[model samples]
Target: MKLINTEEAVGHVLCHDLTQIIKDVKKVTVFKKGHIVKEEDIPVLLSIGKDHLYIWEKQEGMLHENEAAEILYGICKGKYIRPSDVREGKIELIAKEDGLLKIDVEKLHMINSLGEMMIATRHSNFPVKKGDVLAGTRIIPLVIEKKKMDEAVKLAENKALIEIMPFKKKKAGIVTTGNEVFYGRIKDAFGPVIRKKLEEYDVEILGQKILNDDPEAISQAIRNFISEGAELIICTGGMSVDPDDTTPTAIGNVGARIVSYGAPVLPGAMFLLAYCNDEIPILGLPGCVMYAKRTIFDLVLPRIMADDKITQEDLASLGHGGLCLSCNICTFPNCGFGK
Candidate 1:
């Protein structure tokens, strides 16, 4: 930073904020840091009694905050994600379409640990809607070494640190198991909840089959759905390990690879995820989904809808923020649950 005559400050960046005070009126910042001095602002500077102002001196191998922020944004910009206009040395990444957000947590950490820069973002593996601010990148100082920005670019390795996988169009068949629903012992309360959740994505309901707690019948229904071109199959009820629960057995009997039969989450610990023919997904949901505001289903649905395969390690990581507080007014996706 250097001091120069206010008249000679034109085309230079302000080193700090300049406040203008008026008695019995208002005290406001007339000019903010990083603001480029304009030719017409000379009169205002004279009126404000700022004959000499501090300004950042452009030098070799140094970058202004706005320039550094662009590098940070380049590290994060990816498919279905766009950058907000740089403002005050900050640029935010906004989602251009509704989809699942994936982040390279390790890459993001390395850039942040470099000091003098930052990238803040929403939780990874969660659903985000169009216009949601996925991440924000900025430079901490008014000016930074060009080498620092170059290091961040290298950390990206020519790939964006964040991305959005658009949800794929899928036709799903519903398998409602349990003697209670099949035999008319109780009203099928799961259908409404299941339909509402499924419709949130690009999934079309081929149809729903209400079956008894018989593994054979359940497996047959699943096969029938797969034969009818269902890309996804959801089996509600009969997921517990009880003698009467048979959905897990039915899914396994269908020659499907079970990614996981349970998660480290409450209200949906018995949730099951499987893939048939090594492509189609088959989900076995526990009973809590019918009443609970949010469950493991909400956490994993985005990944399935986007066709992003879920591995055992992916499910295991959910344990850290898996347990929901079960608040009365549940604000899922916006809460700590499954974050």
Candidate 2:
């Protein structure tokens, strides 16, 4: 990685991802206060102003400004973020400059959903200078006063910085394991319910399986899915504390590490998460998740589709005001439940 000055940073125009690389980007550098490090292939070391920053090495991948900010958030937690995880947020095209495009998030309504309202912004002309504030976001608590949340939203809009959303093309795999569901005593209502939930995110159903209560068999199916390149896995039924409820055990038997066996939130208290690896995520969902108006699964599915790694602390933070009342108008689009 190499560090370059303002002139070097703006020499080459950035691609659709809004980033370029410096020839010799360094790991770290210290710039004088109010220094203008032009935007180039190098990433920003410190963004002190709308136009001043320190540049670092440029990485490959298409990413929006807010998405990059989210990766930086993972870095703060000592987590690794792949370039593939970085994606475009809300944006729209206005005109073409030379070979570059002039885009604006607010004007284009480029956001994927309201949850991304916190990271949207109108990036200025292409070939932005070093330390230029291409886009900015602030991660506040999930539960804040509605009035306060409204204020923040207004603030971001006034500054032309809104939450950007990633292109959410999600493919789902379902694992149905239960003696009752497997034996067909009762119709498998869970699959349709999960499918409807997946529809909220427009996720496609990649595959589905119905298995017995045997933990070993269930585990093998999950492993098979990993081999099939399933990015998100959801196992329904058999998620209770009873001996017959072996969904959690089945997930563990497959050697996938569970992020949280139980969450602090209601309805989905028995929700289970297992990282088949950092790339493939498996979820053992409870029966409550299938029927509840807004369970923990409802709260989490969006994050997963957005390619976020749910952590223990992140789950624990949902305890306050997690339950959802079936609203008459279903104004969830304006509400801040999952944001």
Q: Please tell me which predicted candidate would have the highest TM-score against the true structure.
A: 1
lDDT of 1 at 20: 86
The reply for model 2, stretches above 4 Å from the true place, is 1-165, 327-329, 336-339
TM-score on alpha carbons, each prediction:
0.90, 0.52
Per-residue lDDT of candidate 1, residues 162-210 (tens digit): 9999999999999999898888989998889989998898888999999
lDDT tens digits, residues 1-339, model 2? 233443455543332122333469733223322233345423443242223323333444433343434532322111111122222322221111111112344433433243423443333222222222334333332122334334433433443222223425766789999888788888888888888888756567878899989999898888887777677889998988999888899898877888889887766788888788666789888888766677778677756765666798878867765556666666652454433
Task: Quantify how close model 2 is to the true structure by its C-alpha RMSD in Å.
Answer: 17.5
Stretches of model 1 off by over 4 angstroms after superposition? 4-52
By TM-score, how accurate is candidate 1? 0.90
Model 2, global lDDT: 0.56
Q: Which candidate wins on lDDT?
A: 1
Question: What value of lDDT does candidate 1 attain over all alpha carbons?
Answer: 0.91
